[model samples]
Target chain A: MPAPQKHVIGLVFYPGMTSLDMVGPHQVFGALPGVELHRIWKTLAPITCDDGLVIVPDTTFSTCPPLDVICVGGGLEQRAVVDDPEVLDFFHKQGKTARFITSVCSGAEFLAKAGLLEGYRAATHWGMREQLMTNQGVEIVNERVVVDRNRITGGGVTAGIDFGLTVASILCGEETAKMIQLLLEYDPAPPFDAGSPEKAGPELVEKAIALMQQMSSLEFANPVR
Target chain B: MPAPQKHVIGLVFYPGMTSLDMVGPHQVFGALPGVELHRIWKTLAPITCDDGLVIVPDTTFSTCPPLDVICVGGGLEQRAVVDDPEVLDFFHKQGKTARFITSVCSGAEFLAKAGLLEGYRAATHWGMREQLMTNQGVEIVNERVVVDRNRITGGGVTAGIDFGLTVASILCGEETAKMIQLLLEYDPAPPFDAGSPEKAGPELVEKAIALMQQMSSLEFANPVR
Candidate 1:
């Protein structure tokens, strides 16, 4: 009978993070009515995304409110940030109170590093699935979206749409998520059949793995975050 | 042999534009090697998207260079922007020099207004398919991504990814586009079948049409730009 209470969602944006990992879900979650969204970072200064796109943070780490949900996106810089005590501590503190703790792509690594994904089934970017498996006490599931209780995780890049819709259904309802899906015109029609390594065949997958390896090596040699 | 020259891509940004409409292609384009990317607008100011996300423009309309490719995304603001002579003229000027002039979703409407899509087969958001067909000289096709010579148009929001990859193949070659696809891990597995009107069944499509109508009306009543 009354107006729906505003739900606050905090989206973590870091230097060199993937744009689609966050923006995909941002487009979906932010479209909901009475939603309070915050793009949180250590500072309010603009942060360059993994691919050269620039995004300005809407809220500082210190000023960010206790969120109903927290989402972290992944990119080339995830390897370096896993050791940042500040980020890990923030995740630990927020994960304690947030209704749902979520991650997209390599963002799961941050949660895995923070011990949030320990003992819970999770999903990460398939390219980095091997590295994620090295994390002790975490179970890796192969799916576009993986949901275990309050911990929700989406696979790499574009999977954020599925992740957002699944979570929206849980938070709002099936009708709401479906409506948002329509609003997004989310009927995906991928022109190519080569979205995954399996679909791409061995040759393309080999090249992709080599490229990912090269990127990781470059990140270590010349860190962006 | 010297290194290949950077391919400049200027993506048009405007207030009330859909974030994913631009960000989707941006992630794909920015991932390419030697991509000199520019997020151009009328001025170098922060603009709010149709959703709540805020993005800062990287270049101004006056300062934008002769680009290899120019992309424009769409949203509720399409109606008002199509009437702006400066924007229409800017598209006209850029279309003359740019190798490829492209658009996503209702962004095709602006190109139509500018007379660039005249006599070209184009794709647009299905919800606004009728309005786009009103252009006497333009041919409206229902495909997700339509490429007629140098004019490339994508259907709806999510189609930008497909559009980007298809264009990338044209510009950089299929190998580069395929590599980028693997890197992005773009294996899309939508949990719902209701992405398009035909796929979404009659009831959902009816509701989606009504929602689109509501959003356009709301935009007219209270312009965000």
Candidate 2:
């Protein structure tokens, strides 16, 4: 018989989560032969993504099996993530049981608030780097991905795919990760050169900032205490 | 008043649809401002992706509004996409109503089968190129994206993102697409050199072909008649 599947990945989804944060990595992890990918949320019912793409969870938070890896994504509804005691409690509990704990973009802020990032190096979306820096005992990194001990972190939404692949490599060996990467052609070509604040011209970055200003104010008012 | 929130884009989803085909594009399209994205299915209930991620539809087929653009994805469930008269009827009707009709991977096949591709130059997932060719008047191109009049097509799962951004340029203007691309920092770095059949080394290509051969019997048995 085929070798028993060795690992299971649990991806936590919440309302307003960035679809790419889950999808980019889901493609990488699902491609593995012995891996099972689970979408987890408060309920098994379908959850709407930030942009309105609705997804159903494979398991509700209460029903999730022991996970080898757990990934939480972030987006416009981050306040919910930051303030939901049940979600924070769940992460705090699972972070101890799981082999690895990971977060993409502002999700790291949630992890940090749960006290999981204490004394660990982490990465987050560029927009939130300042917020991360203020957290005690967390060494914020500017790299696209930062791996400290068993905690893996990624910058912003798109970087989740890269971080997921990196974690897959660490858990399953580089060969498996490479195979999945090859299959998906993870190499991307953008017609334009702007993705980061630094690369995006000042004018474009300003637009992004202006667009996000209202949301940022919400974040400030609802800071994780 | 603000430029009246441009327009909304509606994407159709169904059971067994390739998640990447839709999610990849959702990433790019969902990030834009003045644009609302919706996931529409026959029901507002949750659906499972071909790879196991479950998604909820924003609107039922009967409720979806007149859309600015409609994208239909395809996968192993091509038969369902091509043969369901209700689905075909919806595509046909929506194709005429929407400003653009688009698809990714075997999604092009659905368009061709619906007679939407008559006189159109299209692209699809390489795996389904031959199948698409059997349809009269459908010009299958090998490029990553094909644009003919109002129909836009992408080569495969990952190609959907590229195609979405391309169509974004056409619908919203090149500047909007460029800004979003920069925000995504859409630069991709694939660790493996083999992404396409032509570029993947001979040995790896042979391995892929061998894998494909295993699926040939299934394909022949399930050909959409």
Candidate 3:
């Protein structure tokens, strides 16, 4: 028999995490053959996504086995992640043993704060670029995804899926990743012309900021920094 | 105050479902402002996706509230959905109350089985076109997505995200949907040239089939049809 598959991807889920950031990658990684995907969260109790989608973890952090790859997604919950020493310690300790460490969107911020991204090239949600730059020794790249060494970082929330596929290709073979992509039919066509910071004109981008500003009160209540 | 945004989207999640089929749409719909995306499952316990991706539900069959849109996703679960009397009854009742009733991939098969697709143009995952065409009074379309009256259908698993955005635009406004798409940067670039039956060459398709055939025993043990 072929060498028993050795990779086990451990994905961390917490309350208020962006659903797509986790689920998008989950879909891509889970599709691979001979690989095991584990949803690792603080509790076995169902956790709700930032947008109210609920999911149950396959294993709690306390019981999770050592992972080959450890991924942490970002969202409004970053405040807790940044402040919780236990979470930081977990990342620092577990990341040391993992062959690859990855983050999506603001998740890179947490890893950076945890010292895992020191002297590393990283990517994060455009909106949080400034905040991420505040951390010392971290080189921020403006791209959909960045892979420097064994650490992979993705831009914003949806970029996690693309990042996941790329990581899977790196871990497995390119053929396996390509096959999974075909199975999912990931070709996308947005109805509108706008999707990128450059594509969404200044006015639209400003409007998006204005809309986000309206939620400033809530944002201040839960600042990630 | 602007009428308390009360848009409700009922997402049908069942056993043996392809997690991505429902998840792709969930990410899109959940991103909409003032929208409540509910995972309506048959039971309160966690439901596993085709490849062991498990998700918990916000509401169960006995307690789900009325919906503005009802979205049914397909997977290996189609066999159970097509034969379950209670599931059919629930779909019929929910379809009557929902302003829009939609399906992704083989989910159209369930809608057709429920007698809800009669006199409507529908779409299904290419692999299940013949199964969808057999339904009486259902006009099968080859498009990635099709909208007929209050009925909407999408092809395959990943197409559900596009369908969900289309439905979000119709229900909310094009501007709102565009804003969300822009925020998410919904553009995609698959590394491979294959995704659809047309685009994926006969050789690659045959290879895919051969790979699946290798797992035919498992497929039949958990057959969708």
Overall lDDT per candidate, in order of appearance: 0.83, 0.74, 0.76
Positional deviation of B41 in candidate 2, in angstroms? 2.4
RMSD of 2: 4.2
DockQ of each two-chain model: 0.68, 0.45, 0.55
Question: In model 2 chain B, where is the ten-residue run with the lowest total lDDT?
Answer: B216-225
Tell me which residue pairs clash in candidate 1.
A187-B195
- Chain A only: TM-score per candidate: 0.94, 0.91, 0.91
lDDT for model 1, please: 0.83
Maximum-lDDT candidate: 1
Candidate 1's residue-wise lDDT over A1-225, tens digit each?
677667899999988899999999998897676789999988988888887778889898899999999999898876667779999989999999999999998889888888998899998887767767767577877788999999999988989988999888888878778877876778877767777767777787777777666766422110111
Indicate whether candidate 1 or candidate 2 has the larger lDDT. 1
Error of 2 at A30 (Å): 1.9
Residue ranges of candidate 2 with Cα displaced over 4 Å: A1-5, A215-225, B206-225
- Candidate 1 ranges beyond 4 A from true positions: A217-225, B217-225
TM-scores of all models?
A: 0.93, 0.88, 0.90
Interface RMSD of 3: 1.7
lDDT of 3 by residue, A61-82 (tens): 6788888899988876566666
Worst 10 residues of 3 chain A by lDDT: A216-225
